[model samples]
Target: MTSFARKVANLLGVAEDRLERLAGGDLSEVLLLRRPDGRCTVAKGGAGIGTEAAMLRSLAGAGAPVPMVEGEHDGVLLLEHVENDELFSPLAWADIGAALRRLHERRGETYGWPVDHRLGTVELDNRQRSDWPGFWAEQRLVATASILDRPWRERVEAVARRMAELVPPDPPPAFLHGDLWSGNILVAGGKLAALIDPACYYGHGEVDLAMLTLFGSPPPEFWEAYGPLEPGWEERRPIYQLFPALVHLRLFGAGYAAMVERLLDQSSRNLSTTE
Candidate 1:
């Protein structure tokens, strides 16, 4: 076993019988550790592990399904192993939609999180603001401008300036799973098992929906279970999507530049039509 794994085992006061590495994102290393008593725990080590633990606790407090945090020491976060077959059936999608709806029902006094977070090397600005557009414009859209090329930066700035006209000035500040992609969702037996690896905050709930649809479309069952959305969500989807696209572009390089451009084009077209 690696020293890190041994450290986590010692911290948890468990005898590690076996340790198996699990697939994880660039930001963290994930391992499944089995104890002598046949109990399994997941140990994660990397930047923001403590922040993730806090996010999970917040989710639990808000009645969302998340893995129980066993312990955290140094940079390693230990959590109860959640069983998953990684299957997302139609019913599972509906279940996820319903779960997200229930989560979003819990509102915050303002937009943004109490504390900021990071995704890989990118820093998420979570400074609270009374106006939704101002928060999204400064914190989400324009924050990455320095890392982007001139043309792309200009495009992003244009959209950022039009935030108030494009997005509702005030929507209920619903709790958001800031990163709600399919990969973060774990499923078991055709049902939603848990929503893991959240970059959570309070913002427009549509932000989660937009992120959910960024890489792929959820089935009709999802929308049905999620209930109705405010009008203009279709137009705002690209605007909301731009933040993640920009993050990917910055993290993964030029491969994602096209995605950012595509979203910018869509948002620009929507703005022109409205004008």
Candidate 2:
């Protein structure tokens, strides 16, 4: 098939030549065409968009508020093209929080995402780890610190090492979207229609909260729902945000470099205060 949607359709058992594409997004294109049942539905296709599709499939009908995937073709994912007004609104953010709260309430005996996916222009790897401190040290904090250069690199490593020791013990291992940014929240009818593009994994539930506030203030209700499920994590937001800031630092350049410095400094301050 010429279009990504068609490719996805063929992968999902639809005829490739008969496939048609409808719209496109940052990571994938959306398609509208006949399902084997002959009903029109949306499909997704592109580099690594399948990861996001797989994520949604795991959460589908779990009632946490996400789209449903019909099938796949090539690298394309056939999904319900949900019509939504906007993924970001006061009410939608609150619902997102509530939805996440319910999601985290489902526990696994581990810490890490089942898979990793990109965050906007950034790539986040969610390899499994036995402990949060080591996970943050090796994967999130230390791993990113290794990529830095000069004084800031040393500075981040020092802060990461210190924070790694001080970060609270493993509270509860729960599924996190791993990247719950404003862009991933979808709203319909002034309500949250779904949580799209999750880098699904099991880890500190608060990791999702940290990411929500990393770029900007997610709706208060979003945190409110998650907070009751796991409280006092707002205190550790900076530590979690450091991972993305580091990713951005590597991807965007000095602008993100400055953010890394600030996050490290903030992490040091938070750790000292709690100590």
* Predicted model with the maximum TM-score: 1
**How far does residue 111 in candidate 1 sit from its true spot (Å)?**
0.4
Q: Against the correct fold, how does model 2 do in TM-score?
A: 0.78
lDDT of 2 by residue, 1-275 (tens): 45554445446665665556553355455667665675677666556767877777677645577777766656666667666676477677777777888888777787777666665555566777678787776666666656567776777677767755556667678777776777777787657787776777877877787787787787676667546644456667778888877777776678886677787777787777867
lDDT, candidates in the order shown: 0.88, 0.70
lDDT of 1 by residue, 102-201 (tens): 9999999999888889888889999888999999888998997667778877888988998888799999999988999998998999888888999999
Which predicted model would earn the best lDDT? 1
RMSD score of candidate 1 (Å):
1.8
Instruction: State how far residue 207 of model 1 sits from its true place (Å).
Output: 0.3
